[model samples]
Structure formats: structure tokens, C-alpha cells
Target: MSLGAEETHHGSLKPHDSLFRDAEKVSHSTHRGSQVSWMQTLSLAFQSIGIIYGDIGTSPLYVYSSTFPDGIKNNDDLLGVLSLILYTLVLIPMFKYVFIVLYANDNGDGGTFALYSLISRYAKIRMIPDQSAEDAAVSNYHIEAPNSQLARAQWVKQKLESSNVAKIMLFTLTILGTSMVIGDGSLTPAISVLSAVSGIREKAPSLTQSQVVLISVAVLFVLFSVQRFGTDKVGYTFAPVISVWFMMIAGIGMYNLVIHDIGVLRAFNPMYIVQYFARKGKDGWVSLGGIVLCVTGTEGMFADLGHFNIRAVQISFNGILFPSVALCYIGQAAYLTKFPENVADTFYKSIPAPLFWPTFIIAILAAIIASQAMLSGAFAILSKAQSLGCMPRVRVIHTSHKYEGQVYIPEVNLVMGLASIIVTVAFKTTNDIGNAYGICVVTTFSITTHLMTVVMLLIWKKHVIFIMMFYVVFGSVEVIYLSSILSKFTQGGYLPLAFALVVMSLMVTWHYVQVKRYWYELDHIVHIDEMTALLENNDVRRIPGVGLLYTELVQGIPPIFPRLINKIPLVHSIFMFMSIKHLPISRVVPEERFLFGRVGRKEHRMFRCVARYGYSDTLEDPKEFAAFLVDRLKMFIQEDSEVTAQNEPAERDNSSKEVPEAQARLTQTTVEEEKQLIDREVQRGMVYLMGEANVTAKAKSSVLKKIVVNYVYTFLRKNLTEGHKALAIPKDQLLKVGITYEI
Candidate 1:
């Protein structure tokens, strides 16, 4: 547990120091202020309707049409399909996500990576060893539990951490889940918009299929073009449109029930679902691929939890969205019972003659909003993966100053927009797009089910029986839906899998190289004692200005630093080893962001600073960071002086005791002198020194490893954003030391 004299001096203070206690009080109050008021929660809930429910809300437009691709068999078939839709909406989105999975979030952030982060914090299953002791002290990194309650969780954690296979399997599941979500991001917009645009033919019978496809493509272009405005503006603008769309669907559904057969309400009974499958055995199973579309955006509810709180998402879904969607489905079934032939266009046909055009316009608008949910979720998952070092560094723009989680990645948006347009042009029909979209949704859901089971046993500390029940019920439903969709792999269903495999491969390759590079650095780290000896050599000369060597190592001098000194024999008068660490939480408070310590001793003029950030925190400009580091360095000097004075031995004789005024004056002068020295070095200039590592496979490695390292990883490194660029470091003041690694 000991980190030597360097860490002992800088990382802690004397028990009697009032300054340390006061800082702790401020950090606690800042965290307490983060809780939202009930009124604010309601406001957020209203906005969440536009951002979170868009995909699932628009499902009624094509559910019946997609479900009965070959046309409705009979009146009983209509009731059976409706029953299946009703229970799917209840079990998946309602009981499973809103009640269970949402609670597993890592400090309010959601999705597959967030769940993985939460589990990793409670155990040591993380594949990389980048975490330091200082990281565990973050305000939100909670891993506390009574021994009696944590027995099972501890056992599970030990098993996972002890076995390399288990660790890789867990990480693979997390990455695969993320890939599927990104696939959903592309597929949702295609299916949702195409289904809505298909309604145009109902009013204008002269329109050809190609014309409809072109119109859909144009709408998609406009949708992605406005994404730079950020989620707050988009949510505010789209909320009213979506709110009206939900009300219109619910009203039209009730109208259909009153005018058509109300007896279709009997589909609410679970018996109808059983009977539907019993009458048409193989055909009923295949219909599930279509019926699952009712809950297409269910994963979005959890994935988008980062933009809003759990309460807001829960309220929006259960209070408004859940009832409206259920009613819309039942109304469509009622109309189909009377006019079985109209099942091909149930949503548009069920509308009354006078309200048809207005309803049609709102459905189109609502469909665009639905695509936003998954697109936003896609950005969130990618951001999390990049922070955890599982993805290549890309440009991440923090779109909202007020909301930390609202982000926009231009590269991802551009690629996603193009991919979606291509799919719309190629498939060109709702049924074909539906085949691709269903698989992505169910595969993501199944991955979440498995991850959540581990979370229940470990983080949540639930009983084994509860875990089994959760897995069996949810797992069984997802497996059945997955099988039905996999059967259609030859017919458009392969699209998501193809997309997921490419994405998953990139993630795995990037993560593998990063881990190897980290081990290379760790193995060659220079100890404090060795660094001190190097400084004492006559060939080395200490220069006047400050040097901040950027590294990933927190505990010792990076190997590149020693190499720099040996090659050029020049060192800074004041040197700082700087490292930036991204924790699994959502945000780290400014007061707790930096941990500073002396490298060897006060006379060595060397220091170490570990800057910790939450995944959601933005990196400040390099100049601003330099100024902040100077201020913290000054503060550390004063605190260290105070601690030294307290630890000094008392005078044995009364006559030998120092005067109170003289002692106080002496202490103040010493602290001021040290502060001024640091300020003078700052005025001279500060330079950022970083290492440029070239990674390749070992000479005797396998052919596959060589391809991954020499080709795939090198290409990614050259094309993606570098570490310094991502941190906004100025080129003129930056210095790069080259290091080659054959891993």
C-alpha cells in the first residue's frame, strides 16, 4: 500500500490540519447540490418524451403492417398479434428496463458500457491496469458494502478477476452490445422514416416506389443536418410535435374502437397470445420478428438515460408513452378486425377522412424524432468506449454547456447519416427494412439481459433465485425473438450483424494494442531513485524554464523522460510528470480533479500530478490547465510548510522557545519564496513533452498478430486524433519523444 516518500508527502495531510477538513466539507456540499428538485424533474421528464420515446412511440405506424407481411390470416390472428404486442411492451420496456436495468447505471450514465463500468468498479475484472490508487478516491466511485451482504458479490468478483477467459468474455459482451446499439442507430431511422413516408402513397396514388424512396432520403438528410444544434434545442423544438403526435394516435385508436369491433380488446388477455401460436405453429413464430418492432426503441430508453435522469425517463415512459402506445396498437387491431384487407396500412387507414392529412404529417414528424433517440444513444456509447480506451480517439464536441452528457460527434453523425441513406435506397421498402431493424433491437436486448444478470448478482447484491428468475423470463423472450430474426438472415436480417462485426473488430483491435502499449510502459518505468541518480550526473544540465512531461504512468518517471535526458543532457529547472486518467463515473468536481505530489524531494525540483476526469468531463485548454497547475503547486507548498511546522519537536527549555511573532514571520516568508519561484518559472514559459509510440508485433509473433499490429493498429494511429490534439495542446510548445514498442 506504500507509495514511498513522494506520495506520502503530497497525497495526504496531518490529521490536525483544518485546511484539509474544510476542503472535504466543500466537496460534500457540492455533491449535495446536484440533486434535482421535483419541478426540475418534471421539466426534464417532458423533454425526455421527445428524446427518449421517439423510436418506440412511432412503432404503431408499421407494427400491424410489418407483422402481417403476407396479409392477416383471420380475425383470431389479429387478436393474437395484438396480445403479443401488448405483453412485449409491458415485459421488456416496462418491467425490465424502467424497473431494473436503469438502476444499474454508473452515476446516472446508462447503456452497455455504463453497466460494465459499474461492475468493474466493484471488482478487478478490467482488462487494462491503468487505474491508480488516487482514482479510487473519486467522490462517486462507490464500492462499499458490509462483509455479510457482499459475500456472494465478492465471490463472483473473485471468479471473474481470477480467470483471463472470464475477463475477456465480459469485455467482449460489453463491446458486442455497444456495436448492436450503434447498428440500431443506423437501422431505426431507415425503418421508421420509410414506414411514415410510405403513407404518402395512400393520399397520392400516382407516386412510384422510387419517388417514395427519394422523398425518404431527402427527409433523412435534413434530420442529420440539424444535429449540430445539440440535444437541448432539438428536444425543445421536437417535444411539442411529438406530444401532439402521441395524442393524435391515442385519439384515433379510441375512435377506431368505437366505430369498429370493441371486442378486439379481448387481446389484452394472455390466452390470446398462446392461441395465436397454437393455431399457426411455424407461421406464428416467424411473426414475432415483426411483432418485436413494437419495442424497437426500448433500449433507447436506457441508452439515453445519460441525457436525463432515471426519474425523468421513468415518468415519461410509464405516465405518457406507455398508455398511448398500448392504445394505438389496440385501436389498429380493432380496425383490422372489421377490415382485414386494410392490415397492410393499418395506421393510415384507421384515421377518419377529415383528419387524415394532419395525422399523416405528424406521423412523419414523429418518425424523425424517433430516430434521434438511437442516434443520441450512439454518440453516448461511443464516447464512453473512447474514454475507457476501447475505441480510437475521435473528435467529441460537448454540445450543451448545461448538460454534460449532451454531446455531438461529427464523424459518427456523418457516417451514420450516409449509412442510413444507403440502406433506405437499397432496401426501399418497410418490410425489408423491418427485417434488418428487428435483429439489431433483439440482439442488443439479449446482451443487456446477460450483463444485467451479472450486475444483479454482484453490484445489486440480489439473491441467486432472483438472478435466475430475471434471466429465465427476460432471456427466454429475447432468445425466441432472436431465433425468429436469425431465420431471416438471408433476407435483409444480415445487415445489422454485418455492421456489428465490423465495428466489434475495430473495437477489439484498438483495445488489444492499447493494453500491450500500457504494459510496455509499465515494464520500462524509471524509479524515483534511478531518476535522482540521473539528475546528479555531470553531463545533465537543469534549464531555467518549466517542463510538463505528459505520460500515462502515475507512480514514477516515464521511460521516455530518462531517454530524453540521456540523449540531450538537458532537464527543466522545475519538472512535472503529468498524467490524465478517466474514471468510470459521469463527472468529477473541479475541487477533486487534481492530485499533486513531489517526485523525490523538495530540492529535486520534480513533481508528479495525476489529473482525474469523469468520462463526461471536458478537458480544458492547455494554457488554462498550465495556469491551474501552477496555482495548485503554490497551494501545495503552503500546506506542506504548515505540516512540517506541526511535526517539529518542541523546545526542551523555556529560554530556548522561539518568539511567536518571529516563528510566524519566518514560516510566511518561506512559503512566499517558494510560491514566487514557481510563478517566475511560469512567466518564463511552460512546454508540454509527450511520447509518440510506434507499436508493432514481436519478431516471432504469429501472422495474425502481425497484421493486427503492423497494419490495422498503425493505420488507426495515423488516421485518428492524437492524444495531444484531443487535449488541445498548442503545437509550438509541444515536444514529442519517440518510443518504439514491439509487443
Candidate 2:
């Protein structure tokens, strides 16, 4: 059976009073959207142009120049390349992405991790065993299919879950895809800004390459520096700039078509693409490395979908962005047909004399917008990775209260900005940067295609024949593009590959150590019986006030609690084992935030509380969290008393005996009495008890494991944000206990 089906059956069999069931009543709702008003959709569509289409929109500035770096041999070559560009834009971005891939979003979040999250919900394919039945219920994970399709999905799930190699392969592909996008985060700014700035030399021939590079770097600095203002502000500001840019390009394209070769429109025929490849032979095939640049920002379209709705992205791309970009390419092709020798500067040369200056300025602005899209996408994917435990904790600032998906990561911005500047300075020309940029773009595309193929079978439950067709049609095209780019690896293409390697390594290492640490804690968890025995000991005194013990475990006492008791021989009069879990959805509702259950006997005064949050949910401060916890605890106690009172008469009749005074007192406890007791504990104040695990490799481990765990994981954990700080726990009320683990 599929993972969701299995979980549903298991959950149905659970007792009504099961803790997981209690949490289910308050679980976060599904991320499905209601129908949007047309006006709001249009506004979002307008904003999407600046954030979603910027990278691909700016492609016309460099595609022709990059494609024919050796200069066009004839009009056939121009028409042929134009045909290739047209088909790629239509097939990949329009059909494959806009229509197909966007629908695969995990609760409105996109990108590779989002895809993985969706699949993991349907299958037990995640390597980490942190997911629970409660998580599935809250995440709104489900599927409805005919028996035939359901069997196919179940088969896919069983095969994936059974094979460790398959799971690793899937995760590795996701990490690789994410790494490439982050790599693109730096490369996009470098190429887009440099290409835009290089246009200055067309009118001002005296400007040196160094001067252009300096100017581009300066623009990049300003663009990234302003990211802290968030996507809402940036989108509003950039929408007008990009909208004007599209209009200008479309207007100029029409003017060029009228004045030059209107026949260039015939390049839309697929026959030209075949003919171009046949005539140019190997050279034409290799030119794909340049031709693929037309869809550079296509991944950004899906990646940034979280910033807006899928409908808005579709409206923006199809209604305004696609037609303008296509016309711009056609116009450039027409210009190149007349002046084949001007292939090196087709974008600028094609511009009419009067509109040249204005187009140049807009190109620079649009280029910055393109970079902004990729940078924002990078921040988004990294945030998802961290929440899933694949990446180290980084400070994630949710910029828009209305749009939780819109975020800014200060560390990521600074790193990408510096990387962009370094690359612009080093490459010194758009030609070299284009080589590197094309690899990052196509590699990401190929990864997405592969992941989507799996989604079609396991999640979409498509018939095998249709699934094969989707893969063959899209995968074949991406493979051709991938080959062309890999051929140019030595020609600066290695830049992104090297960067991806570093990033992927960091992510893989971090995930590995985190899983180990979790397993260690799970193996050592303190059972309720053990906890009850420990509390009954005379030496272990229950001190006054409440203590919130933080742990990764969702059930039972944390291993650290027993260790703390052993070391100090003291416990709080009222203690809570608090586990914070990040679900794989976008946001958890505040009403369903905390799941409370008694840990043991009534007089033990101990409880287990799980604070569940979605990936995009913001954590509350310590004081607010304490208030919510106390309020929830009081309700839980009063409900427990009511249940006990109802059962007491049944027990009296069955046994023909009087209840003990202690038992009667517990059953008779009123809501007001419970409230007063909780308030009294609250007035005494709460302490946040957290554990700091120091991990090291066992002596028997291999050299590689030792190096990875001891050095890499240690360095990352030490540098990244601590759990307490990320959760906004107050330092004064926090007590951290250190525990050493050999893994």
C-alpha cells in the first residue's frame, strides 16, 4: 500500500484517546487554495513578472550573441537557431513547466525540495524516520485513484522504500538540483548584469571592459543590499520596470520585423531546427549550449512560485512575458539576417537608434530583477532544506506576514552577492559567464525532469505509457542540452559544478550527522515506567515551578531528562517534555499549534507536549509560547478530570467498593481549580531546559566517517544558529545541558 494509505489504516485502528489522535483535532489545515478574484490574480500576475520571469525575460539580451560566438555562417543558421529557441521555450517552459510541473507543488511551495516533500508524503522514501502518523494527518497528505493506478502507486512506494540505494539516489538528486540553483544564484547575477552593462560599450566605444565590470558589480551590490526589504516591496518596485521592459522589447521587435526581414517569423517551423542541425552538423549541436540560455530562468519560475500563486505565475508568463520574449527573439533573428557579421552584438545593434538608450537602461534594471528572482529562490530552497534537516539551521526572516513563503536570508544574500562580484570580475566578459551559466541552468532542468518523471508515476499515478511519453519527450531534449553544456565544462562551465559540489557536500554531511544524532536520542529515550520510578525516589525531589524540557523526540521522556536527574537529583514540581517538529507543509495554524497529553500518573504532574509547525511557520517568543502552553495544559487537565469522573460510577458498580479519597479528589478537580493551579505555576515562572549534543565518530569508524563527523559536521553545527536562538528562547530562562555521543 502507499504510505498515506498505510498511515490512514494504522490511524483508524488507534484508540480514540491516543495522543496522536488528540493532536489530529488541532492539526494544521491543508495548503489548497480557494478561488481567487480576477483582479487580485491580475495584480499578482503583474508582480510575478518581476519576480518569476526576470531571469528568462532578460535572456534576449544575450542569447543570439552567446549562440553564435564564432559569427553566423548564413541566414539558415540564424533561422535554425531561432527555431531551436522557439521550440525550447514552448516545450520546456510553457508545456512542461507552466502546465505540468507547477501543479506538482507541495502546498504552494515549489523547487526540488518541494517536489521531494510531496513524494515523501505519498511514499516512505525519506531516509530520516522523523515523520509520524500525526504529521501525515496535519499535512493533508492523501491520494484518490482507481484500483489500477493505486496499485501502481503502491508498487512504486514499496520498491522505493525497500531499496536504500534508491532512497539515497533520490535524495542525492534533490541535493544536486538544489546546489545547482544556489550556484545559479551567483551565476545569474554575474551574467545578467554583465550582459546588460556591456551594452554601454555599443554607444560609448571608449568604455573599457574593466569599467563595465566595475559598473555591473556596483549594480549587483545595490540589488542584493536591498533584498532585506522583502519580495513584496521588491516586486511592487520592479513590476513597473519589468512591465516597461517587456513593452519596449515587444515594440522594438515589431518595428524591427517591419523594417527588416518579416520572413524571420517562418523560423517557427520544426523543420528548420532539424535542417540547422544537419547543415551545421557537430557545430550546430554544440551551439545548444548557447541556445539553451533562452530558458535560463524557467526553473526560477517554479522555484519562486511560493512567492505567488501558481495561477498568477501562469498568467504572467503566458499573457505578457512569453509573447514579448518570443517577439524579441524573432526581431533579433530578423536583425541578424540582414547584418550576419553583427552576430556578436545582435541585441544592441537591432535596437532602433532613438530607443537604444532607454532600452539599455531598462535592460540593466531587468537584469537586476532577474538576479533578484534567483537569489530569492535560493533563500527559499535553503529554508526548506533546513526545515527538513538536510541543511544546517540558518536565520530565516519571513518578510511578508501575508505571504509566509516570501523570505530573506542575510547570510545567503551576502554570500551570493560576493560570489556574483567575484565571478563578474574574473570572467570579464559575458561569453565566459554564459558558458558557466548555461551549465547551471540545464543541469537544474535535467534534474527537475527526472524528479518530475517519478512524481508522475508515484504521485500523479499516470499510466505507464503516458509517463514514458512525458519522460522521453522532455528528458530527450534536456539530455541533448545537458550534453552540449557538459562539452564546455573546461570553458568556465566547471565554475558552477565546483560550487555545487561544495554545497552538496555540506548538505549531505549535515543530514548524515543529524540522522545519527536523532537515532542516538531515540535509542536512549526514557520510558514512562522508568520516569515514574525515578520520580518516586526520595533523593529526586520535585522543586517548585515548571520546566519545559526541549528534545527531538515526539514521545516519552528525553534521554537528557534522566541524565539531568542523575546529575542534579532534582526535578520541577511540574515538568513538560516539549518536542518541536517542523512538518513538510507551508504553515501550521496557531489554534492547532500544541499537542498535550499526560505523561504518567495524575500526581506525577508530568506531561508530553509537541509543538508542531510547518516549514514556513514563524516561532513565537518564550513568553508567548509559555502563555499558550499553560492555557492548553489547563484545558487538558480539566478534560482529563471530566473523563475520570464519568468513569468513576462505572468502576463503583463493577467493584462494589468505595473510591479512595485521593482518587476522588483527582476526579472532582474543577476547571477553576486547575486554572488556579496552572496560574500559580505560571507565576513561579517557567524554565526552558535544552540539550546540547556533542557528537564524535566512534574509534571503529572508517577514516572518511571520522573526518566527516568530527570535522565537517562539527564546524557546521558550531557556526550555524543554535536551536534555542532560532526558536527565540530567552537566555535568562534557559538552562542547557551538554551530552556527549559517540556515533
Task: Give all TM-scores, in the order shown.
Answer: 0.94, 0.93
- Best candidate, TM-score: 1
* Candidate 2 per-residue C-alpha lDDT over 1-743 given as tens digits, one digit per residue, 9 for 90 to 100: 01111111111211224344444566444333336678888888887887778889999988988898888878888889999999999999999999999988766777888788777777777766767665555534453443357777888899999999988988999999988888899999899988898899988999998999999889988888888988675456788999999999998888888889999988988999889988999999889999999999898878777667778888898999889999999988888888999888788888999999999989988888888778878887787777778887777888877666668988788878888899999989888889999988888888888889888888788889988988899989889998998888888889999999999899999999988988887787666668778898999998888988898876656678888998888888788888787776666666556666666766677777778886656778677888887887776676656555665655444454455555667556555665787688878878899888899999999999999999999998898888787778888999989898899
lDDT scores in order: 0.82, 0.81
Worst 10 residues of 2 by lDDT: 1-10
Error of 1 at 553 (Å): 1.7
Query: Model 1: which residue pairs collide?
Result: 54-370, 55-370
Task: List model 1 lDDT by residue over 1-743, tens digit each.
Answer: 11222543223311224334324644432222139898988888888888788899999988888889889878899889999999999999999999988877766677888788877887777777866554565667774442355778778989988989988988999999888887888888888898899888888989998999999999999988988887666567777888898899899989888888899889889999899889999999999999999998888878777767888878888899988888899889889888899888888888999999999899888888888767877887788788678888777877887766667888789889999999999998888788889998898898899889988888878777888999999999999999998888888999988998998998899999998888888787776667878999999998988999988766666789888897779888898888887777767777667776677778878877778787767887677888877887777777667666776775546775566557868999988987888888888888889888899999999999999999998988898888787788898989999988889
State each model's C-alpha RMSD to the native: 3.0, 4.0
How far does residue 23 in candidate 1 sit from its true spot (Å)?
A: 7.0
Clashes of each: 2, 0
Residue runs of model 1 more than 4 Å from their true location after superposition: 1-23, 26-37, 143-148, 645-655, 659-668
